[model samples]
Target: MSNDDELKQLRERVQYLEDRAAILDCVMNQARGHDRHDADLMGSVYFEDGVDEHGPVIKTGPEYGDWANAAHESVFEDHLHNITTHTCEINGDEAHAESYVMGAMRIKGGKIVSLMGGRYLDRLERRDGVWKIALRRCTVEWMMSGDSSVLASGAVKGFIKGKWDRTDPSYTRPLLLDGEPVSRW
Candidate 1:
């Protein structure tokens, strides 16, 4: 191949990688937003007209955050959305992605924890130099429950608890340890 053609191919390869990375970031950020109950962060991953369908529940992207936070708070004291086994197919400015999700949630009474596995099927588009989900469909693959009574034990109490807000340690910047660590839920 000519030098110019080789350079063009290299640039195209780099752009493809960048696009994939951005799409993965968008997918992961959605899970983080849900875990933290951050409405703005969750909504920012979608386009203005994006839509989300989670089983029988369907809502616009911008409004889904509040609904999701409320639903989660009602049943679980804490929860996490873990993403795994993600695959994406890109074509021009549009892409389709499927991400496996494992949701671990602590029941309100701390007596039991639920483990649910699912997949997020997304149709994403690149607009104005930004990648965002235009449509998302969620599927629940399987679920199970486990005892979480140990959470009330003294050993668990000593650990720094997580918060469903921006105050969570994950959001801490510079991450310097102060005089003492306080467990704030």
Candidate 2:
């Protein structure tokens, strides 16, 4: 290959890697947004006209956060979303991704907890030099239940708890302990 051809290939390789990184960041941000219950953050991952589906239910991306927050609040006192084993296929301006997700939710009354495993299937588009989800579908593969009474026990009383808004420590810039309890559940 000519030198110019080799350089062109190198540049394309770099662009491909950059696109993959951006896509992964966008997928991970969804988990962060849900755990923090930050509607704006969640919505930011999607285009205004984007669509999301969870089985029989469907919603526009911009309005999904509010609905999700209300649903979670009614059932779980606290929750977390974990993303793993992601794969992406990029084709120019559009890409598809599949991400494994596990959700651990401490149910209200602290009597029960639920664990759900799922996958997020997304189709993303690069628009105006930004990548965002244009469509997403969620699949629930398995679920289990367990006792969560320990969450309210003294054993965990000293641990910093998570919050459902921007006040969550994860949002704290330059995060320092400051020698205080920080916040609680």
Candidate 3:
């Protein structure tokens, strides 16, 4: 191929990689925030009307946000979410992304602990020139015993110990219940 043609191809390849990386970053940030009990951060990654299915029932945007915040608060004292093996497909303004995630949590009591390994399947859309998640479904591929004390301690450590600062726009608000803010600590 001609030098100009090769350069053009290289540019296109670079653009594609950049786009993929951006989307991956968004998904990773959202997952990390959720694991770390950062509700606002998790909400920021989704569209206003996004759908989330973390449990048996699917939840709407507002419901998901509420549940996420509350659930994270009640869970562990600290958490670390590691994502890997991401596979993404882009078509026009829509895309699908999937990744494997392994998470560890430290509970409030030193004796209790919890861990979950899962796969996330996400649907994304380009909204107003930016890519945002429209739907996210988490499949818990595996989970360890849920120890209350260990979970609480881990959550406290995860949120209060500044682990949530690794990402921009952290979700630092208190968890809510029944539309009202509730204390999880």
Candidate 4:
């Protein structure tokens, strides 16, 4: 109808898209934090008083951050988390979401690898124009084991090595590279 009305509608739509993108980023950032053992970055995804029910353990957001980072460092030699899918429902400043997560890990000083499947049910809220999880309920589906000896011999060339910190190639990799690469970790 009116130009102003159309402009307002467009603005609202943009805001919604922006909110969704930010929320997705927040979710992905959690995995990256875990993979990198970055406790502070992981903690930023949740509210200060947020709750996390991780099946056997229930703790506050801060507590979860500490526990998770510690466990990964002590128990897992290497781990990677993948977010497969998620459904989000936005209601103004409040939102509800359920995201599927898969984790693969190699235990410390061992050749056995494990796979874990789960979902993260989150209650999010926007405060001070920033959206963060207020509560997260984790549901574990299954866990299976595998042998890592097949690939443990040596990593093939042209594959980027993963690190457990900001030093990871994903963080500092350049957009363009010419000639043969020369690096490994």
TM-score attained by model 1: 0.96
Query: What does candidate 4 score on TM?
Result: 0.89
- In order, the Cα lDDT scores of the candidates are 0.93, 0.91, 0.73, 0.85
- Model 2 lDDT per residue over 1-185, tens place: 99999999999999999999999999999889999999898899999999989788798888988889998999988899999999999999999999999999989888899999999999999999899999999999999999888766777877788889887888887787783236764
Error of 3 at 180 (Å): 31
Model 3, range 38-111, lDDT digits (tens) per residue?
Answer: 66767778888998888797886546756865665676556778898899998878999998988776665545
Model 3 misplaced stretches (Cα beyond 4 Å): 2-4, 146-160, 163-185
The reply for model 2, stretches above 4 Å from the true place, is 179-181
* TM-score per model over all chains: 0.96, 0.95, 0.72, 0.89
Q: Candidate order by lDDT, highest to lowest?
A: 1, 2, 4, 3
Answer with 3 or 4, whichever has the higher TM-score. Answer: 4
- Clashing pairs for model 1 are none
Check candidate 4 and list the clashing pairs: none
